[model samples]
Target: MKSNKKFYMVREDMLPNSIVKTAMVKEMLAGGEADSINEAVDRLQMARSTYYKYKDGVFPFFNAENMNIINISLLLRNVSGVLSSVLNCIANLQGNVLTINQNLPLHGVAYVTLSMSMEDILVPVDDILDKLQDIDGVINVELIGKS
Candidate 1:
């Protein structure tokens, strides 16, 4: 039988102890708390086989190290407050706007490109895009580049 499974983003406190321990063990290994997998599992009182089983299946919601720079292009309606709304959305997500380039409005639409630092963004890029799409006067949004 073939099965399709759905995953969820749940709070840490809601997870089972074993799953939490699996994440802990993975972190310990990544942070060099232990020289080897065996040592890390031993220190955590978890089995090596169990750790390996969940190693690839579990990870933290956000890894700050991966937060870098991203450039996005947007086509917005030529209207007052449209640009402000976009910037405000980024700010609300804690994204730092590095540079903004906007083309003059033509045919009731304006093209905008923004470069931002993602070091402090609370959620993933996809979530940010979804929020931007929810705002009025935003015609379209695309992730042009990321680093």
Candidate 2:
């Protein structure tokens, strides 16, 4: 059987304190702010069990070091130059497009899926999405996956 896991993008302030603290602890350990898990948890006054429980589950969306590739789905008005404009926007943001798939327009709307490398992107992913959404004839932009 396949695992039925799902992911969501949530505001930091809305997360429970334990989950937030676990992320902080991981950051501390990775950044050398704390020498070990024990030290990191102690510094944060968080329980070791709590850290272990959430360590693998919580991650910051804008962590450039860990997030290298991302896939996005877009809805576009079936007008000339719309797709070109979208690609230009991604290139302007320094995102390397790895793959692109566009379905035939149906009812004046086109669906496009793009897989791109975020390694060279200077701006945050959210900013990239915002810029894409701002383009004329672009109906919507959604970040569907990341790795």
Candidate 3:
């Protein structure tokens, strides 16, 4: 199956009343301003059905920009200096590391997942992957999210 969905960024002032109200309701819920959906809807004077219909579909523009966050999973040989080498390579490329989670080495290999921002990276995603793959102890480097 193919996805035909498309997204656009528009000014808040240009949005319809329902969409704006839905956003307010979402904020109320997230900020604990309202105890429940019913309370939020009542406080915002918006129908509960309307809030549900658009809550999942609408997000602040800043969040859309955060789509640049990339998740990379690596399989590295369980040996000294292997992980350090990977970090150095990423640092050289100017990618900003956000979060890293790694599993204990087992059976001569360790699984590592890293979330980083590519906004300031000097090289393209493919180039970074190529360099990572070329590392001596890096058995695999897989891009796990949108690049």
Candidate 4:
């Protein structure tokens, strides 16, 4: 049977608060931050009905565990050792770097794209992005694609 369901990648800020809250409630439950559905909804000030309505449809992209390969784009200051630091961060998280494409520095900034295997990643993909952003000289980090 063919499924007609469609998926889209949307920025969180552009989505309705209900959908976002629904995802949050689900995470709270999964992470044991909320013991029950009622508690989860109440903690977020969301109605039980709203939670049920969107629960099956809303999911965080980074939570897709079956995805094995992820491509990320980074903007970094054109300085020595910045790119190396980013690679080290990924390695430390158990992600295997598969490919890297870096552009020449333009106006003191460089754009780099990396494809990595997530098969052995020890942390959530979102956490990897957060760590990359925290690295010195990294101007921006964005998840470009995943497979």
Please write out the lDDT profile of model 4 over residues 40-138, one tens digit for every residue. Answer: 999899999999999988988866454589999999999999999999999899888988999999999999999999877868889999999999999
Query: Which scores higher on lDDT, 1 or 2?
Result: 2
- Candidate 4: minimum summed lDDT over ten consecutive residues — where? 59-68
Candidate 1 residue pairs in backbone clash: none
Superposition error at 123 for model 4 (Å): 0.9
Estimate, for each residue in 61-101, the C-alpha lDDT of model 2 and write its tens digit. 75655548999999999999999999999998888898899
* Candidate 1 lDDT over residue span 25-109, tens digit each: 8788788898888888898898878888887778788654445889999999999999999999999898899899999999999
Find the candidate with the highest lDDT and give its number: 4
- Quantify all predictions' global Cα lDDT against the true fold: 0.87, 0.90, 0.87, 0.92
Point out where model 4 deviates above 4 Å: 1-67
lDDT of 1: 0.87
Model 1: lowest-lDDT 10 consecutive positions? 1-10
Best by TM-score: 3
**Stretches of model 1 off by over 4 angstroms after superposition:** 1-67
* Positional deviation of residue 141's Cα in model 4 after best superposition, in angstroms: 0.3
Worst lDDT run of 10 residues, candidate 3, spans: 60-69
Residue 22, model 3: Cα distance from true site in angstroms: 13
* Candidate 3 ranges with C-alpha deviation above 4 Å: 1-26, 29-67
